[model samples]
Target: MANRATGVPAPQLLFDGSEEKFDLWETRFLSCLHILKLKETILREPDEASDEDRWKNADCYAELVRLIDDKSLSLIRHEAADDGRKGLRILKEHYSGKSKPRIINMYTSLTKLRMADSETVTDYLLRAENIITALREAGETMSDGLIVAMTLSGLPDSFKPLAVHVTQNEDSVTFAGFKRRLRVYEESEKMKMTEPTTDNVMKTYTRQGGGHSKPHSNRKEEDANITCYKCGIKGHKARKCYKKVWCNYCKNNTHAESLCKKKGGQDGVRKVAEEQGGDQDHLFKAKYVKSDRPPGNVKMKGIMVDAGATSHIVNDINKFQSFDNSFQSETHSVELADGNKCSGIAQQRGTAVIHLLDNAGRQHTAQLRDTLYMPSYPHDIFSVASM
Candidate 1:
């Protein structure tokens, strides 16, 4: 709007009594008055002003009435007609967030804002934007770097890496830049979860000195399509060719006599001793496989392949993809490898994420079902018996 007398443009910003817009409107209104050489009319009292100043004050009061909504105008309408300074003061008290209590409340809300578990980064940032805007409108001098810090402080541990990246560049980065980085990180995490995972290779061993044996069932029809290299058999691999191996105990060409089921008790012991060429102690055996990935920054301490364990167990609860806290029971207990037992009062069972190496020896994520929680256990145990 242009002034009819001075031909100067009046402040275009109108205040509709909105708390967030009051600060901007007031600033622009003051700037417009300064440009028109009428700021003294509102900033000075009537008694201290001259005839020209008084006339200018009246004009300024009229301009204020024109720039505000009915609700805001009503706040200063009853003031002295020429004393625009008093009217402006009345409006400032009502619309400006200068009150100590109001500013305190806004700061409190800002500090308490947190990102919920199911909330996306965009959603959380939007929610934070509202509070930050309110605080700034209240005359609080919150800097962009402080706002970024507050946003990162409210996020969960899953966003820790992203938070660190943003913090390191806080001096050079804008809040908008941090938000874009967060979105990219979130998308990458989602992609990692959806992609197919390879299963890890696990090898197990028996405590006793015995090798795998083939099943005894051998029908002629089953062997028709198969051939063995050792004995030219039609149904099995050379290692399982029973026709080529003689069993001294069974006294037959169908199988090895040492593997003969008829021989039991001391004979089995004698066969094992003969094969080893000496006596052997019956001891538990287990193999723990370390991930091929770089060990310096590995999250998991280690995974042990326990040939004797009856169930898979993990020490870290965060590794579980799905968990059942209700699986905990006081009656349950776990016996350690050292023959010590830990109470099951705090134990829980769930499906857990287990890192594994595929056939190609590449690291991949895999899930293990019915895994037991053993916080006191020294190492994560993958059970052959459980499999």
Candidate 2:
């Protein structure tokens, strides 16, 4: 795909001249060559390569030259551009641990390695493996036992149990075996935390000073007593109601397009909000509203009108005229089209300025009441349904 900013095909690999990341960069470079069916051409010797292969190798060599930094390219500039194999060998030899200082640095880094809190086990292992690979290529020996010990030593305190389990096991633990057992242990621990407990139910009965309590009904029995809003039937809520009463106008399942109150305009905002699950009485929805083209002075591109949006949302705090910082609690959140909730502790609601331009190019400003302020919101949305 073309890059959005540059309108050019983005480079597949971008190497920042660092010896630590060279191995990964080389692997990706070779993989790209393989995909283009030019890996064989690059690998073949100049003497053995056919006339057609020589032409293909030029493209492969160009890709190599494009990916590497200027400093790395200068090392192999004397090598023929048509001979990718020889140029790549020269680049590899230069990067693959020729310096004594670099080897010592790598060894020092390996010893001082400690997993960060934000890093996952797999990511930490990959980092350790990269250093080990670099050490081996530098002619330094690395044993599997030493590799396991180094890997285990770098893990954070949370992974101590897994380390202990690996060490105390009857069978010797390879790095591969430890990874497998770690996956299983992590999943099992998650299951233990998430699984529901009857301890709360038992505690409820043990509470003091309460009269003889009636037995709680089972979930199925409770659902049977509840009425569904969608179909006016017992046993389920509107969300679970099987009856499909579709309103094509509002795209709601509760009613038909022909019977849609929203078609009448502002009168249906409250009714539509109720159906859409917005509990806030002051929820804004744009049913029908006239707006003129905003002149260049106003940032018309920054403002977006969402027809399906249940509330007006503003990203910038400066847009608010008179704000209510405590308007909404932390638990109150706005739902997105993708079924994800957007919430922040700093979220506020109040009157906001809405800039507009008339047909005569006269600038006008209107007050947008009950507009939500989400500092982390991606866009300033004017809800058509909340008008």
Candidate 3:
């Protein structure tokens, strides 16, 4: 007779359990096919649908059913759909009927499915076995090959020897044993690659000399103090003493003019000496000569004096034949100590050589030093010509 709900004659009852349980298995199988179909669709058209839509619309269970009918289950055995539903089916069939022998057979079939493709099947079986073990101990023991396959699946690619160890010793298959074997496998892999140790890492880091650890050194500190000649101080040298003295040339008590030997003047001189209680030999002599006109137009021939000079300069201006003939006129402005401006001409030809007459009337050439460009200079036109 036609069934009211399905609108077809009901098939003869084949199993003893309620139709609902069988319907559940059928629905689960269809759901797996739906998942596969959705996966293939997404792989082909990733942008077309969201992940949830693909899962909902997949037809993996239908594909599995077709695979079983055509005896092409081997073709799709390692596929995601088969792995999901087939493992569930085997477990359900094994536990559903009150048949211990049939349960063992079902387990054998499941193990065969696992061995067909070690990568996919081993992980699935491990999870299944863990669940099965938690619920009820596995009556059927695992074969050495299956255990090896399971172990190999858990280990990293470098530690394949762990799988071999498991295959060799199947009787002592415990979590602790697996961990020990994994450690051994890792050590052997490192030895094979000739990898270094923690000490080598520390040495490499330490040699860089910029790490958190202290630097390695064998040298010790030495003394750096010298005695000062003028003041007899121990912290500094005599060259750096800051005593002041009178300048006999400028008649200024601010500094001794003997040390003010710079030709142009002490317009940019940093420090000056003061009048301290000392003998004449200890004090510098003042030497100055005044003129009415600007020194740029005058001819100068005297010793090149560079005492406390920030820049090269010429003091005496009466030695050259004519200052205008020796130097081509280029407008150069200089700044004085009183913030006054003065004009000068740059020498374009040979150096403005100075022939100095010492106290003995002996002639000696004074060394021409380069002009100093102090910040006090109005413009940077105080450059000296190369001699």
Best by TM-score: 2
lDDT of each: 0.63, 0.63, 0.38
What's the true lDDT of residue 217 in model 3? 39
Provide the clash count, candidate 1.
Answer: 4
Which residue ranges in model 3 land beyond 4 Å of their true spot? 1-95, 110-160, 167-171, 175-387
Candidate 1 minimal-lDDT segment of 10 residues: 276-285
Residue pairs with clashing backbones, model 2: 284-386, 285-385, 285-386, 285-387, 286-384, 286-385, 286-386, 286-387
Per-candidate TM-scores read 0.37, 0.44, 0.19
Error of 2 at 253 (Å): 67
Between prediction 1 and prediction 3, which has the larger lDDT?
1
Candidate 3 per-residue C-alpha lDDT over 20-121 given as tens digits, one digit per residue, 9 for 90 to 100: 234344444444445445444422435556665555434433433332322234333454353434433543444453367645554554444332224333
In model 3, how large is the Cα lDDT of residue 1?
22
What C-alpha lDDT, on a 0 to 100 scale, does residue 140 get in candidate 2? 91
For candidate 2, write residues 121-201 as lDDT tens digits: 667778887998889888898776677777788877877767865664546667677767766776776787899853221
